[model samples]
Target: MENGKLDTRALIQTGVFTALYVVVLAVFGQLGALIPILQVMGPFYIPMVCGIPFMLFAARVRAFGQITIMGILAGALVFLTGQSWVVLALAVVLAPAADLIARAGRYRRFPLTLAAYVVFSEMLIGMVVPLFFMRGDFIARISQRHDDAWVNALVNLTPTWMFWVMIAMIAAGAAIGALLGRTLVAKHFRPAGLVT
Candidate 1:
């Protein structure tokens, strides 16, 4: 990018990849909403599915801020989907850290990019923030969308202690997702010369 600022091409790429990431997140997120079991397991699978687009985006990143932009859009997407603002807040914090991690590698080192994505993926923890920090409000907000019985069932299914478990799951999923994305990039993108 010229003058260390993202130009039109980078912004356009950010938009396209962010849109892909949002679509992927929304589709999987809805599955969790429809199925409590899936919701419980969301920390594991959602990040994994999102890896493809994220890795593709990472491949195209020529300057800083692209990952952060995607993270902000992702946060906004979650907010638009009726989640608390915590997601957005976490994005503000975590996305920049991720951006720095990638910048350390000049966005060309695969391992650093993978680590950045894992960190970026942790922003999803905001989804669970309310469960621990704002339980009453979380329940109140969720109750509006789901029946009390379903809400109760979900609450019962996810104990407060499980928050830590969810964090671990998110981390594991992010690692796997990054590896899977790396593999795909190697197998397909590299051969196709889509990324170097």
Candidate 2:
């Protein structure tokens, strides 16, 4: 295929992936907003495991720039749909980071490199961004208002927790995504003669 045609195809694929991400996140966000217990774990949507498929698709098409586009689209969708704007900004910032990690992995050494990616990704989204955007007063108020169980849980699952809960959630999501990516790649992508 010509370069322009290839780029068009990649763009379409990325758009589809980003739309799927936004839909999934919106569903989870609704769930989290409605249910108190679900809100505690926050439905694990922030780390954006949806991006894993996009990253793999980028690797297949050798269209790394699509990652940036996917990030922007997904972030915009989230903001438009009422997710925190801070998270939208953070997604834009973190998308390139994810692309770099995916590039380094080359879709090989899935366990180690992908685990590192998930860890850093979760830290950036779940820990650092929140620490920057969320007010100390807000956190303190939440801590004060809630029982020690809730406060301790949040603290234990976050920065001091090395953001493990977020990591675990992303890892779980990514594992599923990777499995799906493998099958999809083998079927639609690999046969297209794209750059795996």
Candidate 3:
């Protein structure tokens, strides 16, 4: 009976954390619109901040399923709250990928795994999704606006440079998330007995 009670409490906590993640994403989405370029820039770090609590919760509770569910819920809530449905859909898809990468970290391999999380999350949510949703003419227009220099620069870089850049940004974001998560877990979650 005691074990059952603990399980119930943990579940409730998980739900609350998931809701919190959604709220954070919604808030960030509003920020993203106010600064669309920041959304594309790859190092905005908002998603990383949002993922921290969930990462810690996953580590302590060993509940990757709950974390993944929370990511989906976060994406959905962000969409329902007036974010673009296309981006929200991407978020729903990418959040699970991020959760998988984080879970694979097993609370360690911080650098590599977190990098994967960031890259995958950003590419899916930032680049590829936008590529599809945005009109080709818009991309061309932007390319022309830059005097073709931007596209030329990309063309000049190594074939995988774009991919690596995305990965690097993800790594940066994950590092930020990990640091903030540590602080938050220590300051609030630990004191509250919510995490180890």
The candidate maximizing TM-score is: 1
Alpha-carbon RMSD of each model: 1.9, 5.7, 6.4
* lDDT, ranked from best to worst: 1, 3, 2
Q: Which stretches of candidate 3 lie above 4 Å from their native place?
A: 1-10, 41-43, 84-120, 123-128, 131-133, 136-168
- For residue 76, model 3's alpha carbon misses the true position, in angstroms, by 2.0
Q: Name the TM-score of candidate 2.
A: 0.59
Clashes (N, CA, C under 3 Å) per candidate: 0, 0, 1
Tens digit of per-residue lDDT, candidate 1, span 1-196: 2135687888898999999999999899889989888999999999998998898788878678889988998899889988878899999999999999988888878889889988999889898889877999888988988998889889998888899999999988988998888889889988998885
Q: How many angstroms is residue 16 displaced in model 1 relative to the true structure, after the best TM-score fit?
A: 0.6
- In model 1, the Cα lDDT at residue 7 comes to 78
Instruction: Please name the candidate that would achieve the greatest lDDT relative to the true structure.
Output: 1
**Per-residue lDDT value at 137 in model 1:** 87
lDDT of each: 0.88, 0.55, 0.56
Question: Candidate 2: where is the Cα deviation over 4 Å?
Answer: 1-6, 43-60, 112-196
**Candidate 1, TM-score vs. the true structure?**
0.93
